[model samples]
Target: MNRKPSTIPVPVLMMIGIVAISFSSIFIKWSAAPASIQGMYRLLFTSLLMLPFARPYSGALFALRKKDWIMLIASGIMLALHFLLWMGSLKFTSVASSTMIMALEPVFIMLGAYFLFKEKTAVSALLGMGIAIAGVIFIGWGDIGISANNLKGDILSIGGTAAVAVHMLIGQKVVVRMPSYLYSLIVFISASFVFAIYNLLMGIPFFDYPPREWGIFMLLAVVPTVFGHILFNWLLQFVSATTVSMNILGEPVGASILAYLLLGEQLTGLQWTGSLLVMCGLAAYLYAGRKKGKDIAPVLDNAS
Candidate 1:
């Protein structure tokens, strides 16, 4: 693939996106609203905030083909399913089991991308993925529980990972065909719609949250949804979906640091070691990409 470097390197941008999303857990912890309700409002606010900036692509957005709309909607639903399934899993299983399973997202994405997009990853990159996944397993190893009770949660987490992998693969297809923000706008709206339906079905109050909760929702939208997810969405046009998914491994590391400083949570020795391994794996992955040439491809100027 012929490519040119962007103003900022892909690794740096990926780091920034990871840091931005690291705030998501903190914000969620601070909020008191139902999970689906918080998700609905966060997505709703993100789409609304993106509207003004998307004016330039308004015409192209409307001109999107039927297939584009179908893919976008399917992508959005998968994203919502990810949240729903992951959150539901937490209630039934240990956090360690759930998180460790969720960390397999990149593997799921890698397989899908390989088959569907005909993308091939290098041996070093696959090794990097293995190391990163090993790091995650180690981070949660102490608390991992295997029991009949945990089976359901494990399955749910697996489902969630699959859902997100599909969501990412869809984004890889759709984001390249149009401007990123415009593509994300439709996805955010579609996801918010799904979340709204979930909220209604669960009988979660829509407007009963206090100001603090609202503030948390807004922060969720701005930080993670826009800066985190939208940034990742924008990145899909340049990098392979598996590469983007691999970058997500950094989120747990970032979140652990933030949890330490902000939430007064203490990191165990295993966590510190796990974080180191994750960083090393990411470094190796970047090296593999660089070795193969084409770090960040030049954006195709297709407004449609």
Candidate 2:
């Protein structure tokens, strides 16, 4: 007799994804490769690793309707663009600033849901988001400045955040119909293709990287790209896009702590305070979400 497969709880999976993605910044910082180059290999390797697993779902992929195909391809392009812009932002701005700015993804997602889906948001959730945004501002207060280059980086990060928000919102609709692994495989493959073309256009060499850099690339693929992002894609089937994006706000806190421990980066008193506020606000938001009932209700409640 065949036994059934064991399933992990959604909350547990989300926590694991958060922890896994938190290391993405640290890995990027440790590598000496150019941002696009690092992003290219990371997606390329992730696609390769996912190939064997996705093969079983070949029929599912082939059965996709034209609309499904369009959404998947668009989502994949946005994902690639998000990585490119975010990685580029890291070159000119501090990690704290980049990550903090990227955390604005939820705001974009909320706005998209409102305009595209006619969704409303709860007042409590809005308050929580405000608190979290304030906390992120506090954490990055010192790093933000009026410099031209820094402003450019900030703009890039904001663009990346918008791209990713669009990706997730699309996934929220598509993933409900497609199997998680199959959906992720298609998106990853598409992103890898985009990255490959980008590398070729820029004349960036994919091979001949140092052994250490290759190792970092592999870690990024296996840990963050696969485990972290794929898990979020899977969770999108159960939760609203806004909820998933809000949870991602924890990345800066996790990345900051890792930077402190691994990279010897020091945090300020305000940063510490801000970290606590973020945690508290996130918890409040999630709690309010659960209490509201329905995956969409938390984000769809009237603002009042």
Strongest candidate by TM-score: 2
The C-alpha RMSD of each candidate to the native structure, in angstroms, is 5.5, 5.8
| Candidate 1 least-lDDT 10 residues | 295-304
Candidate 2 local lDDT, residue 155: 71
lDDT of 1 by residue, 1-304 (tens): 5555667899898888888877776676566676677777877887888778887898888888999999989988987887777656655554444554565665677779888978999999789877866765555543343445556766776788888888877887888788766776788789899998888888888898788988998998888766776677677767775576555556666766776687665545665565566566666766676688635321111000
Kindly report which residue stretches of model 2 are placed more than 4 angstroms away from their true locations once superposed: 1-18, 145-152, 226-250, 269-277, 296-304
lDDT, candidate 2, 60-110, per-residue tens: 878899999888888888888888888888676656666766765656777
Model 1 misplaced regions, further than 4 Å: 1-19, 86-107, 145-159, 226-250, 269-273, 294-304
The clash count for each model shown is: 0, 0
Task: Indicate the residue-level lDDT of 219 in model 1.
Answer: 93
